[model samples]
Target chain A: MSDKKTITFPVEATHVMMFRRSIGDYAVPDTGLEKAAVPPTFPRAVAQFDPDYHLRLKPGEAWFGSGKKPSGVEGKPSSAGGLHAEQHFEFLRPMVPGDVLSVTEHVGKTWEKESKRAGKLVFTERVQEFRDQKGELVCISRGVSVRTERPVDQK
Target chain B: MRLKASQISVGDTFEDILVEDLKRTQLVMYSGTSGDYNPLHTDDIYCREAAGYPGVFAHGMLTMGMTGRVVTDRFGAENVKKYGVRFTNQVWPGDDLKGKAVVDAIRQENGETLIDMTITTTNQKGDVVLSGYATARAEK
Candidate 1:
């Protein structure tokens, strides 16, 4: 828990716009999108999380485990920093194209634990909030990331 | 059966999202719907011992679906702009889950209105089981 940080970044309407465009690609009966007569929108409320939004990172940022690859097991290590999870939103009140959407992020907590394969595991939680043109809370998001050490059995 | 968004005001709350009982049928259907097949939600014996439950519990999504029913009731499906939520806690079977949403904020532009909601789900014990925010287009 000692290595915790807090950071914030402003996300705009375009961020929301991108998520709406891509979420459908992930849609399948598995996530419950099968029976719809037409593909549903990501809902304007969740437009802020385009996932494609270039992750705003700070200097000296180090990632741990390899991340997910578009293809398979040979892809990037996902948890070098940690396994990332997110919650997204589309503002009921538009963030509008030019509005300064303040995104405040904080590395609230981090912890480590033993792992059967990787030997050790570290996890981090990041919280982000976006505010709209009126200085009102537009969206709140939490990201959880997990990283694991190399397998003890590895050569 | 339904309440128009205009009929509600800031601080006003709606009736509970009623379900007779958290039957296995609903949970099974929900697992199929949500793709969350955690054994704790389906296997009664495993839930009672490993998960420390009296019996199987309802999927958080089922409770969320109940909450969505509230949104569908208030704004109808067409006007709902977004519906996203986190599963804050759990709801077990036989729990009387009630959902209520209060208008927390509102904005208008070009005659279009969007309302923010502080939506909550609670058991009969009045303990909040799930909590999240929702936004919808206000009817003209």
Candidate 2:
């Protein structure tokens, strides 16, 4: 089954400024970018508008298991502990303010592994592709989240 | 800053970046901006009592984002073709992270110049927190 969904949002300058400031890129030369161009890695801000944005907000939920209800997993706690294992990005074009991005995300991979501390670890990969208003590919992002069988405290 | 394709060699190096110290306010702003509100990153009480962490830590993406500046500052953002990273260690508040990107190879493919690079970010203790590679098109 394909767990695919599409999200659309305009790149806002205010959010871009906030992201730049948050990362401490304050010395960016004022090349009149307050109106158009955005900082590098700005496309990642799209997560703010995801409908399931709340899924990643909780600390108790496993980073991999967040978003899906605990009922989805059998013989395990509703929320487990996990980590953000990896991230990859491919940028095809520069993203600027006012450009509306249509992002589509779907499950990419699922696997298991044996670990000394966490016991067995389950990993889930999600890939998000962003296209411009003209349907031209702009960026591709892949995120890997791994969930453990037991909590950190239990380990 | 733009560099000609011919000017970049296997040993070429981009300017190193001294990242600002990780701060609590920066973590909160990142959570709000990136929508990654994991309590281990933003809430101190939850980190201590529930997560059993020393304290709130910066998001991995935040460190990645800061490390990326080394590339965008030298090659321009639009030039980036691929970037990937492996999280090696945690970044704590007050830690001063330093990032360096070195050219690993320069190849010509399909009439386009491609520059490959290896990136590493280390904290004040000289411990590597993140390491990865990136590929970008050269302006020349």
- iRMS per model in Å: 12.0, 4.6
Question: How many residue pairs of model 2 clash at the backbone?
Answer: 0
Off by over 4 Å in 1: A1-155, B1-6, B49-53, B84-88
- Estimate, for each residue in A62-107, the C-alpha lDDT of model 1 and write its tens digit: 2211124221223334222232222334444433334455555667
**How close is every model to the real structure, measured as TM-score?**
0.50, 0.83
The sequence of per-residue lDDT tens digits that candidate 1 reaches over residues B45-135 is 5444333345666655466556655665566544655555655455776767777887887777567787778777787778877677777
lDDT of 2: 0.74
Report the TM-score measured on chain A for model 1. Answer: 0.47
* CA deviation > 4 Å runs, candidate 2: A29-40, A55-81, A149-155
| Model 2 chain A lowest lDDT segment of ten | A64-73
